[model samples]
Target chain A: MTTLMNRQYYLASRPAGAPDSSNVPARDVPVPEPADGEVVLKNLYISLDPAIRGWMGDDPNYIEPIALGDAVRSSVIGRVVKSDSPDFAEGDVAMTVGAWEAYTRVPGVMLNKLDEAAGIPLSTYLGVLGPTGLTAYFGLLDVGRPKAGDTVLVSAAAGAVGSVVGQIAKMQGCRVVGMAGTDDKCRWLEEDLGFDAVINYKQCGDYEAAIRVACPKGVDVYFDNVGGEIFDAALLCLNKFARVAVCGWISTYNVPDAPGPTNLWQLVAESVTVQGFTVIDYMDRFPEGIAQLAEWVVAGKLQFREEIVDGLDNILPTFLRLFDGSNQGKLVIRIPEE
Target chain B: MTTLMNRQYYLASRPAGAPDSSNVPARDVPVPEPADGEVVLKNLYISLDPAIRGWMGDDPNYIEPIALGDAVRSSVIGRVVKSDSPDFAEGDVAMTVGAWEAYTRVPGVMLNKLDEAAGIPLSTYLGVLGPTGLTAYFGLLDVGRPKAGDTVLVSAAAGAVGSVVGQIAKMQGCRVVGMAGTDDKCRWLEEDLGFDAVINYKQCGDYEAAIRVACPKGVDVYFDNVGGEIFDAALLCLNKFARVAVCGWISTYNVPDAPGPTNLWQLVAESVTVQGFTVIDYMDRFPEGIAQLAEWVVAGKLQFREEIVDGLDNILPTFLRLFDGSNQGKLVIRIPEE
Candidate 1:
């Protein structure tokens, strides 16, 4: 066989703020051979999530920060090219912790084998039926704890996790309200996703007023994705015993000095519980979550959008679309099979 | 009988910052007659708490803000001097939502009759066995949810609620660390209350460094009373899945523009739960809490301090002492009965 090569995007240095190409530079190296109980795969799809930005900084998180000179961590789906363990075979498709690279070599035990005959797109495993979907399901049902007749307010309501959260909350018999960055996104939430109300946050001059108008009963459960001024206003509009499920704060991820919520005192005023979590917090229950999410999708109850960028070269720029609110839904880079 | 007069400290105007004499001034008016369901009480002990300061502002709270031109709201143990309801008779002692006045007229149904004959100090009803103690009990046990071997950290450790929280957390088999303002207070928490470690925040040059040294195991539960720079620093030292029980942010109460805790991002970093509550939140279980606290005090297992100022006129100044950390433990005002 001719020499095989792998192109990877490796972290050159920790980012001070929003990462630049200099911080994550392209590197070309020969893909390593699979060790015992390891499998080598040609990665098919690379997931781009806002959480990736958080991992780039050397801050204490649910997981360790990506170390310097290592490939930036991500979740990817791929087809196995070589295997050294009976758990996997050549040509078997699977998914595992991966990076912005053409190939990945991982322990066979780490890979969750995917059925190519199942007729479901592999990219769906990286979006609505995967981490983002699990995040919304667990965060909303367990943390947000929306009761029937409760008003559920979700920020970034058009994005991957938030969209799934709003849909599941509606299924729980809640009055779901969404806040998205654009009128089009808001329209999608209201006209298509069956949201009770939608606030185009980009046009909503005063967050508190818009929230009050949209949720006249006051927010009983706030699914927080974008933290900052929006979060501050949501604090003021919380009902007594409100629950704030914080999954991410994409708005503040790039601003190192973002001011803290001025109205946090409302937590005491309303006897609120604000819990922060990552999907990994519910790792043991991901199987249950994925199965339930898949059922919802099959029943036509769950809808999602995935933006597929065609090449690894566009990964960094495509990932930045999450912060700018330019991406319509879950974003992924597909590396066409050679 | 000569017309009875009530000496009330009324809210003359809202304060811009720390309440002064002008914000709360004395007034002598004839005590009003009891309505059909009301009983007039000769106020004996008025509870002074930091929550009263929060009520002074027009901010939304567990209860309505003390109405402008009304006597400042508080809990008072008083003797029934006049009755229009059969539930209470003249000279019977009870506690109800009273104000900073020599006499309070309240609905008889709202009065919790005190068994002063039990030999416990009547003032104890407003301190250790009352709101402050109950706040510590439920906030720590329910919200903090400390597990055995957990490291529990408390701010304002010498204060009424914090002192109780640390003791209860110890009872639950957790290691307790306290932060106080003075060396004497720190010694009281350490030598007297059996705290595992004490940090005199006034002398500790760096809050995070002191906390790390004191809580070598990392903080699993943080009972926060004073919020400001101290709370921000404490957030940085939380362990994974830590719980922060926020009862009161006394440090920020008087500072209208007190910058919010900047390191709140740690909530996500450690999957923390920051829950805010008042003793009122546990209204249904107050009796259980009081009984447990009383048992602990009777068994000499629970200890508390109360600085009872001699007169109602001194209530404002004594309440301000809570902010300065000058008044030790639970603070109350005694209106010596005739």
Candidate 2:
């Protein structure tokens, strides 16, 4: 029997600040055969998320840290190359939490079958139609609970999760204002994504004032993906009984010593609720989120952008693009076809 | 009819940082007669709260800022000396949002009649059975939602609201850890209030380490009355899905430019919920809170302490005691009894 050599990125060392090549190193290893209820998958697409920075550190977080000398953790959409379980068969496309590798041997229970005939690209499952969509859907609807006519403000508006959040808020009759890093991203959000207003944080001198002008009635719901200065500005614009759904603090993920918002007391003055959540917390309700998001996509109401980086060897540099605000949308790595 | 002279404190100027005699001045004016639906009340007790500091500033808060040269707002227990309203006659003890004055003519609709014969002191109406109690009750039960065996950590645990919060969390079958400024206050919390652990933050070398030692299991519910370094420390000790009921940030009330918590991103890592609320938001459910608190007080299940300052002339210095942490328990001014 011939064995497959898998190309993978391993955690070399815990990062001091932003992760670099020294922290995550690439290597080639023989892919192990699946035993009993496990399956071997050939990863076609790997999700490059800001959260990967968090997994590089030893700090306690939503997910466990990737041990040194072990394969870096990631989410991937892959095709089953070999199966030893009744739940999965060869040639089946599956989405699962796996390592940053060309091929992964995972338990069958961990895999979710993906429909290849749905017409949507398999890469979309790693983005808007998958965990990202589910996060935006549940975080905004359940935690934020933006009512119609409410002013909804979202940070990192051009990003994968945040774009969906703004659109969903608009669908709920909310006046959506988004904050993006660059003028191009802001233009994309306002002109292409149907955002009512877009603030370029890079250009805005007074973020609070800019937010105030965009959200004339004050922010009723703030979907925060970037924490720090943006979070502080959003807190100042909170209306009475505002809700802040803290999905991710991508801006602070790399800077381990980043300062918190100075305007948190506004939560008390405005009777605000700031709740933090991850998509896995709503795992049991993924079907509901996927169904709703798929309907929106089918109806041409929800739009998504993917910035795909090719080859497994480029994984380390591709993941670094998240912190630099260079990635235009859902940043994904396309693993070379075996 | 001869008009009575009224002694009141009015806002002279907005304070830059902490309020003083220059910002809040005492004035003598004629006590006005009641109109058709108004009642003349002789203020017997004036509640000195940390919230008064916020009112001294021109910035917006839960309630309106006290206008310059206007009477400073406060919650007071007073005797209805005269009434033109159909609801009450003279000698009825009432609780109402009024001004820092010897006498006030308020609309009868704004006053909540207190049962003087219920055997609870009228001053207790300003503390444990009043807004302070209601703030703790609803803030903890409704917002914090602490379950049995949960570790509840409260800052300013020797203060009026914090003390009550600790007691209530204990009554609900949770482990409670309290942080207070003075060792005496810490002793009071553990010995008198049944707190599982008490940390003297002023004496503790490392606030987070002390908190971790006190709450080994981790903080499930954090009732934050104080914000600043203590708040930052508590954020570091939060457990997964912890709820933080931000009833007040008294520590930052006097400092206009106080720094926010540096570890707030722990909310995302731990999936925490931090909500801010005022007691007035729960006005509709005040009766329920009062009933429950009154029962606890009567059954000896709840205990409270009062640091009463006599005479209206001492109002400014007495109010200042709140920021300096000199006043113990519910600080109240015993207005000279006629």
Candidate 3:
């Protein structure tokens, strides 16, 4: 058996603002041969997300920047093509941070075996049963600390993590309000996902006014995915002792100059808490998070949707759909069905 | 006795860029007699704090502002000159929240009996073993959650609250750093209050550099009293999971417009928690907090200083001391001991 397989590598040129295909060029390269405890995986699905925008920058962050001449670092759902250790078999499905290409090798330590026979789709491993799932679970429970009957307001409502967060809040008996970019997403969130209320931030010229109408009792917990003006609007409507979990500032990611709220005095008046967190922080509790999220999805208490594009070449444009607020749900790049 | 009292009102003719005696006025009238469930007290000491500046303004706040015609509202340590309440006696010492007056008729519900035989000075009730002490207790332990070996940084080191905060952090086995307005205050914080390091913001000129020097391993908890530049400096040096208890922003309080930081992006990278709170929010646990603070002081584990000024007329000037950062520790007006 040959140890080598082809992988994708991004080349020189970092974007000044929003990234385009011009900035991320995939190149074919010799696959890394597995070490003593490594596995070679055939890429199946790649998680395209707003956080990936941060990785394109050279600035220091909680997570390391994706090097200019390396495969775009992403969470990938793949099948084991070969294993250098006894832990994994050739046909085993696994989830690991891997390349954009067809085949790659990753350390056994970083890979989690995925049970494809468990009735969850392979794309779910890149979303609802994977990193995004863990992010929503830990971020809401640990950071937001939503109480029963608390009013929870989530931004980017129909997005992968936001949808999960609102559903989880509802499961906790909270009154959930969602802010989405479109009326279609709002309708989906309200009718399909069991959200108590939905606000189309794009149609609502005054974000704060929309929040006021949506949350008449004031927001007790805010799970913020899109920051900037949305965050500003949410802050003004916070109840005393409100909890704000800042997961990602997707709105600010593409803007060359991110303009935050000028009225931060609201934070002081309400005795609120604003916390920023990375999904990686709760890695130790991933299994427990995934198990509970999977149970909720299977029980129909939580509903998730994936907007998957069928080809690898469409990955860049599909990724851009998130920034433009055009993607209706979890945007997964479906590798051409082998 | 006539139903009137001699008190001072610090009327805000215009919001002061820096508070001065010109913005305040003194008035006199007959002392009011007590009503049922109320005590007529002669104020022993009135607390002069930076928070009084906020109360002087017409802006909406946690507590109501002092109207131009009304007496100034501040915390006071008083002796019951006369009483109609079963809980208080004529000679008993008590703490109340209506100060800047020679005499006051206070409700029983708002007064706490002070143990005159406890041997601690009466003015100490206005500071340590009082609201300031409780603020430090709950803000650091309850909100900040400092663990053993953590590095704690406190701004306004020699002030009533920060001094106790540094001492309590030391008791928790944290390496405590204190930032103060003067070199003398910084020296006192290190030599007398058991802080591991002290930096005088005035001398350092570069607050960020000073914080780096004082907190070598990075700050795990920041009890922010003087916000503006000190908070900006601490934000830069916070470690992952750092907690900032925003008890007050004294540095920004007097300014017409509070200048926010430019480097708030650091919050995302460090995953810091910034929470604002007041002692009133923890009123249910006040007894526990006060009891613990008193025990620490009695055991000589906590030490404090009071800068006392004589007469009710001196209340405005003594409070002005807080804004100028002239008062070394707790500023108290003696209220013309008669």
User: Which candidate achieves the best TM-score against the true structure?
Assistant: 1
The CA lDDT of each predicted structure is 0.93, 0.90, 0.83
lDDT of candidate 3 over A1-338, digit per residue (tens) = 56464747473577878787778877767776777989998888888988878888876578888887887778888888888868898999898888667776888888888888977788988888888888899989999999999999999989999999999999899999999988899999999989999998889889989999999999999999987878877888899989999898888887866654545555566788999898889888887998898888888888888888887778777888899899878888877655
Best-fitting candidate, scored by DockQ:
1
All predictions: root-mean-square deviation over Cα? 1.0, 1.9, 2.6
**Per-residue CA lDDT of candidate 1, range B74-190, in tens?**
999999999998999898999999999999999999999999799999999998899989999999999999999999999999999999999999999999999999999999999
How many steric overlaps are in each model, in order? 0, 0, 1
Q: Would you list the rank order by DockQ, best first?
A: 1, 2, 3
> What is the overall TM-score of model 2 with all chains considered together?
0.96
CAPRI-style quality class for the chain A–B interface of candidate 2: medium
- Two-chain DockQ for each candidate model: 0.83, 0.79, 0.44
Docking category of candidate 1: high
lDDT of 1 by residue, A258-292 (tens): 88888999989999999999888999999899999
Model 3: docking quality category: acceptable
Backbone clash pairs for candidate 1 read none
User: Where's the lowest-lDDT run of ten residues in candidate 1 chain B?
Assistant: B259-268
Q: Fraction of native Cα contacts kept in each candidate?
A: 0.75, 0.81, 0.40
